[model samples]
Target: MPPTDGTPSDTDVRASTGKKRIPKACNPCRHSKVKCDEQRPSCTRCQTLKKTCIYVEKPKTAEEQKIEDLEQEVLVLRQQLQTQRDTESSIVVSQPQRLMGQRPPEITSPDSNASLNHSSPTWTSDKPLKRKRSHFRMQKEVAVPDFINEGILSEPQALHYFNSFFEGCDRYVPIFDGSDGFAAVRLRSSLLLNAICAVGCGISGDASVDSRILHVRLKRWLTTVILSTHAQSLETVQALLVMACWMPERSLILAIATRMAVELQLDDAFDRLVNLSISRPDTPETHILMKSARTWFLLLNLEQILQVDAGNLVDLRIKGVRRCRTLLNRPFSSRLDARLFSQVELNRLRAKVNETLTSHSDDLLQAVQEARVDIDVWYQDWKRIMEASPLSESELPSLIANLTVQRHWAEAMAACRAVRATGVHQVEMMSPEAHDMLVIAKEALQNHLYVMLSQPHYLANFRYAMDFVWAKCAFSFLLLLKLTILLPDVARQDLLGQGRALLNELTKSSGYGSSKVYLRLLQLTIKKYASRDQTHSGELDAFIPEEFIFEWDFPGLNLFSSPTGWDMLFDQYMIGDDLFVGMDI
Candidate 1:
């Protein structure tokens, strides 16, 4: 948000160095060489003198200004495309009068459902269907107007969703760097814009667009566009990766996405970016190249997770990638690059743990110990870097710190599962390793919740809130659910109470779409078993947490392995294709 400085601002706040936080001076103060009490609509001197106060407007972040520019460009392009279609078809289209002058609804999109009203402009469809009149025959035709509603919705709803995503999610994941800022750049960039709209719609938690139907249409369109495209582009790969996060629950889409990423040489792009970083300064090309690393690393991270869950080999091989080794060691040019570099390193640690546990059971214990040390070192280094930078001023620093804590927790859980899977019959409930693992999970959940609650401001931004919040909620619930069964009655009740509070917070209060339904599903799952005597009997069989960490897909979560299924509930949402099942993993 650019600050308006027509007057003095809040000059009271000062940094530790005694520098005024509001440094911008009024024009009168600047000319008189007097210290201006950077105030609001007017400064103290301006108020006293009855003179006009003019302050320099604070510059907007490149990410924001750029997106706004792109949005404008997209709008222009849409209008031109509309005109072109009309010209080609030899028919001019006219918009309805009601829509021409009406103000669009305010759109606020986040990755998950938080800080959102239960209803949004996106949820309600007020437009009447239009029938296309044929030239020769009086045939009626209804087009798929819904296809680009997000793109062309009068208030530019897609712009809101797009900006919201960059604000909340892209900072954590830098797929959309401002290097490609112009509307022209966006226009030429294949499915990038459309894919962004798709993810925005998915995470916005708006029910206005039929997600199930749009999911199919978007996937089909994405596939069709990519297949016919003769060129591979960073935008296409970036979009596919975004969808991997947006629609993660779909295994087949991920498989196909993995293939698309490979075909686009995302890894090779990472390699090129690494060399470019060392060979050149932070020029335009280098900046873009670095962003491609973020895209590639994200793909590797998701692919690794899916592979671990499926017990298949993730096709990406980063170890041999020359840039993989040097990218982290080099000085980061931007916050996005630094954050992405940290994620790549973290995912590498995860992949190591998963690969060892699955491929070499004989070495699981040894490997887990080593991986723990590696992750700790990585976390410490990244923590230091984060503290050293301006990121400390933002929620990202702690948000990621909590994520790191959670990742370690997932590692502990996987280690516990590995111990059991590796025929550790000697390990009893009272065994030190088992107890240690349980405590680790408990501590992780506590710290994760602490971080989340500590930063209410971050969670308040519903647009980007969904992914991180959703992941945290899902992971915490499962951990607490597991602990509910594992702990003694008093301790179990305490954990259960917390779990209930968490569910109630989202289900009863949160107004975002799907949150109530999702939380209710969790509550019912707990209810179905919370009362059974067998549940509190220290039965370990009832507590298999999803081993794959960092999974928050709407279609994925499954509870109650008790023959009864939650498929009926989930079937209401979630859409995907299954043609890529046999793809090489």
Candidate 2:
């Protein structure tokens, strides 16, 4: 069988193999129990028959078969488990409807297991929610622990507090639209509801209900439930926003709320809707989205105000201010929208002044002057809005009065910063800007004081006596005092008396809890100033005492804690007399 050539014969190769094994047969051959070469394209028998060539898989062994069965069983078991979960979810969802005739089980806390079923239904339902119970609202209905069910938070007292908020404080902040009344708040978030009540307690003069208990419980709930759970929602942001405006932990709360807002993309929602040309739906959900957009606007506005208050340029862009105004003009907006819009616009101008003051450019004075022009234009535009009579006799006259006061306050602040831009050293040698600052400051103080005194009822409201107003009063007082001390001839002495009267009225206002502290510190500073003789003033450095020249803080607020504590006043008097003897004002 061997070939003559070097190539080996098939029989010789087969013989060299000790035991030649036949290949596994293809499907056709295996059915007939015939041998196969295991060729891919065609078996020899199938090719001869001109039939389709097909190969079958090898049979699994006993162990492999057992493993395959186990895998199939696991897959079936997983599917069964999913089915069971779905059934349980359906039962839980239907249980509330099934017991519609009977009272549902009471929810002991916001974390109760039953509340999980309410989220999807509450948000997706298109029907008016007056008839239905929302998750938070339902939980609120049931009496909870002492913390949530006592004092101002109790059901009996909660309405009065909420009413006080809506009537007194809501006009200033304008967070709630007052469409569904308190239901809009209670249904949305228990935390937000509590925050609203706590803020309302500041204005609500209810003696029977102690506000201290409500405040303590709210703080507990904020830290333990909402913050610890890392809850994120539009309601939570609103709650945090409300708290930041009134709470002592303003900066920290604002930071956290703003971070959550970014995570929620609240600032982007309006632009996204506009870009996509998505028609807003006439549903509760759309209303919520619009409110969120407005919330973002208010957040933007307050952030800018705080930055300007701290004497720093706002890091956020001004476009949000514009967008917020547009959003406020949308349907469901309130008459108070104009007030908030005016504030945003005013703060925008203040931000520009702050930017110019912080810059080191040589044309800083010109830039500040230009900024002042814009501020003046703002006053001219909003003045009519501020002066227009309220549409209804029931509308709070203080709303317009407060806006007017804020406008004057904004102008004074702008002028004060402009004076800083002029780099003035002495009040005796005044530049155009310094003279303007003196006039504006005095006029603003007189205007606001007249408003407060002529309508002394304005002092009874929380908005008139809150921290910002108190700060304005304290700042105006200090500025006037310094000016009078520095230039007895140029500045009016009666302006100081007017400033003192304003502080006295503020202290007399029952709603301002910290007015005493504000007035007391100011009085001590004035006392210190009077103890020193300004008549012998060869140099203006000794006009203001060293203690009054630095950062000043109240008990709860860092009111005058800005590094530029005296701003232009610092340049004029805080420096050593040698540094500024020959400098031009």
| Most TM-score-accurate candidate | 2
Using lDDT as the measure, which candidate wins? 2
C-alpha RMSD of each candidate structure in angstroms:
28.8, 13.0
Question: Candidate 1: lDDT of 22?
Answer: 37
Q: Each prediction's Cα lDDT score?
A: 0.51, 0.56
C-alpha RMSD between model 1 and the true structure = 28.8
lDDT of 2 by residue, 142-236 (tens): 22233244443567577777787776666556656656377656764677778878767766767776766676776776654343323456777
Provide TM-scores for the models.
0.58, 0.61
Instruction: Write down the lDDT that model 2 would get.
Output: 0.56
Residue pairs in collision within model 2: none
Candidate 2 positional error at 234, Å? 1.5
